[model samples]
Target: MSRSGVAMSRRTRLDSELVRRGLARSREQAVAAITAGRVLVGGIPATKAATVVDGSTSIAVTKGDDPGYASRGAHKLLGAFEAFGVPAPGPEPGPGAEIPRSTGPTLVVAGRRCLDVGASTGGFTDVLLRYGAGTVVAVDVGYGQLLWRLRCDPRVRVLDRTNARNLTPAEIGDRVDLVVGDLSFISLALVLPALRACAVPDADFVLLVKPQFEVGRERLGPGGVVRDTALHAEAVHDVAASAAMLDLGVRGVTASPLPGPAGNVEYLLWLAAGAPPLDADVLAGAIAAGPAGPGRRA
Candidate 1:
């Protein structure tokens, strides 16, 4: 049989194969597992969900669940908390239990009303809740994408089909104490002003900075990945500048612990309302000390 024919004969997409073998509950879960570096095929880490393999190939999930989060995006926020020294509160406190206090200017999620933009699958929202957010307003432009458990959680207010760019304080009901976002297909510049309007004077932010979306299409590498280190730096700088224009201080910048789906290295940007931007040298040092990976140019 020809190569195409052979591929069509018994080969299956890795996500489908994972579902067929009962390794994943659905193709979405399988893709999450694959991109999170948890799925291995014949002892090799699978990089793409659409990779085709023969029927007899061995496939396994290195971890049974998505590390207890609703989606892999939770890991990104969790990593930011650790990297920035933001304290996450423990489980619901008993009558005499005390909430942990933040050591620095890093935002503490405990007891804070938060806003989660681009809250698809409720991953960031889940992280907020896990860290003891008093309440979370989950907003997404798309409808019906949040997880059922999050939608049912009393603390999460679902705002499906809502555009973050047009959000107002009246719409959000009250000013938020903190904001977390993981937006795609749009620049954070367009939404930062709106987020600023919806937050309190000293509210902090932890937003995922996706270079693939920030950089122009002409700069993207194959599969829409931002492979140039200078472009990565430019993207981060642009976002920081935009935040500065809004009077939101750039608290810190760090590379994401996990790469994007197309193997692009993403970044986490920490900001606070009405604070001064970090020193350029300090920001550069933080980026250098962050997790390094394949696409980082020397």
Candidate 2:
């Protein structure tokens, strides 16, 4: 404040001021420095790292470090976006669309009886509803873990403690137009059969591919991670091949924008019932890029 020869403005927490001023490298770094007792404010040491500060505050960092994602698996999805050319999710321009133009355009799940095989916390289900799906039958083995926001939504019908393999057309009482899955502890091969049973000709399929599950237990690295790129490729191919055999056309393959827990990379395979098979090489290349990663317009 003295530098400006004006009354030193009310002081502020150094880290907050830095972030507010776009001076600090990152919020994580600011917090880390404050936690490490390396940040000073107004020529005095600050105690709590998250303390608030003002524009006049002076700060210094004692070290350098890398900031991390909400989850480490974010990097895998980031890799997918880099490889694929799918548009990143962003704010859509203008008004009048039933679906808000922003927050990523909804994939056509609306008015179509749909199923989310592994609807944990309902991320996909959330996306499905945003797209104006008539109803989403969200099935998961776990109980009461869906996001509260989705559970309260009228469009969703939660089916906890249900196994996808056990689902039948009779239970739904109607055929499904789209069946999206994100299962764990089971291979897509096992789940595909049940989905086939539920779909009519011309139905759409979107399932997640986790190399950790598709590959043999032996190939999994420490902590149940699958780090091999080649194995990742094989897992995608195996799922697509199985779908092809079921007479489900492999429409497209993309990476999820969000990574799975335990940092395992995941994939999204789009399929259509009764559609012709896709060329293997083309399909593989599309997945190698961000199938569901960046470039997705919101």
Candidate 3:
């Protein structure tokens, strides 16, 4: 029943409606805007992208709500790079400009091939490209979630509906110099082997560690967040051990600058093939210094 005496059509998803109404250029942008609390329905804030609305329902995007990236996951990777002092590629030197030489061993991203596991909406992939990765193969289990601009970028190869646990080097066509991941619902241990198989020798890795997925269900507090600091340490330690068994060294670990979508305090793990295992003391210190609090609804 409509106020104007016209029957409303079937409900449409908020993200799709944003696209249909030209409020957003793509579903990815719509999701980002929604997640950032910028989307309004009938003059009230809309919380979820999956929310359904009728044809006549009013929708609005808040002004000046840009997040500066396709997804907030970009901040997680950026934080890791800063905490670990990983070198970002500088702008190209103009003709005859002086080139600076490195004084120590550094994980260089310039002109390097990369693999982005669980690259939904291409947040991490966007950061990699901005930092100067030459090529990025974005793999996700779901279909049609990447930003349209990233899909059109020649440097990005979209591998939608592909499971990372079964990923192979042959499919990627070449060994990657770096690997970055921001997976959900799945344990990193299950996909570490596949990631290792697709990387070059001595390749670098920056993976988000979601404690809620790594810790057993019994350990999770309300709302699926690992609130106990001890549990957080245990989860990270277990994943680091798993990587070690696969010959992947845990180079560093740090808390993400921003909490996860659910306000779960997530971690960023830096790994490298053939590097030394992470020291137990360093692991403990990182967990102790991490964001101290329980998860909350964002």
Candidate 4:
């Protein structure tokens, strides 16, 4: 018991506490917020998901703004689209306001038949829809994680329990013109083969590259983050190598505008039929092109 006669109980994870307080929808969402520099505790930014804070800790999100997508991932995919000049559907998310989207087929999201692998909570799906994808097949290994709004939309074909590793064009019915993915807990190399098998002859994809999941655990530094810039390049090259073997040409690799959950810096790898992975020097430059993240979050 403290001076106020309130007991300070057991310390719990910051992410779980955020969920318990309804500040975030899930632990994953909480971590996403924290990593995006959206979460603050006791007037300070939260640097990791494992921050041991009490349930009553003074936790709050930055500015109470709607982070655009269903989760912070919307910012990530949007960053990829804009940085790569792909463009997505919908208005820019900010100032508690929504931005309007383009009208027709863009070089990317607009008017495309798309697939969203690991579409948890529909951040990527929301981007696709807002950008004008003719249709979206939301595939996830888990069940019932997509937002209800996306679930009810007729244009979205929900495929729950569908592992991207096992996905085939036959399963999706028609080839998708564009594919966007945000997967966790598995190396992308395992999912690339299936993603290749399900795309249109010249389909393109924008997928999040998580280094912690790609590099063996033994290589991860404290708090399970890849702190070495060299390792970041290696992970990209390794995954680019995987894509090449499948004949999915790598277009570019850019550091995500946002860090991944738990402050893990992530990259967006663009793949298509014609382009090849950026040469080592070019890729190194791209990896450092965006905002220098992984600062406070670490």
lDDT of every model, 2 decimals: 0.79, 0.64, 0.79, 0.77
- Preferred candidate (lDDT higher): 2 or 3: 3
> How close is every model to the real structure, measured as TM-score?
0.72, 0.63, 0.71, 0.70
Clashing pairs in 4: 88-131, 89-130, 89-131, 90-130, 91-99
Superposition-based RMSD of candidate 3 using all C-alpha atoms, in angstroms: 13.6
Task: Report the number of the highest-TM-score candidate.
Answer: 1
Model 1: lDDT of residue 47: 60
Colliding residue pairs in candidate 1: none
Better of 2 and 4 by TM-score: 4
lDDT of 4 by residue, 1-298 (tens): 9899988686777877888889888655675576556888998766555567886678889865544567768767765665565532324556965443533222467788999999989999987887678999999989999999899999999999888999999989888989999999899999998898888779988889899999899999999989888888888888888988887777666677678778888988888777765478767776665433211100
Model 2 TM-score is 0.63
In candidate 2, what are the lDDT values of residues 135-214, reduced to their tens digit?
A: 88888889997878778888778889989988888876677888887788999998898898888787877777889999
How should the candidates be ordered by TM-score, best one leading? 1, 3, 4, 2
Off by over 4 Å in 3: 1-67, 88-105, 291-298
Give per-residue lDDT, candidate 3, residue 10: 73
Lowest summed lDDT window (length 10), candidate 1: 289-298
Q: Give model 1's TM-score versus the native structure.
A: 0.72
Give the worst 10-residue stretch by lDDT in candidate 3.
289-298
Q: List per-candidate RMSD values in Å.
A: 10.7, 12.4, 13.6, 10.8
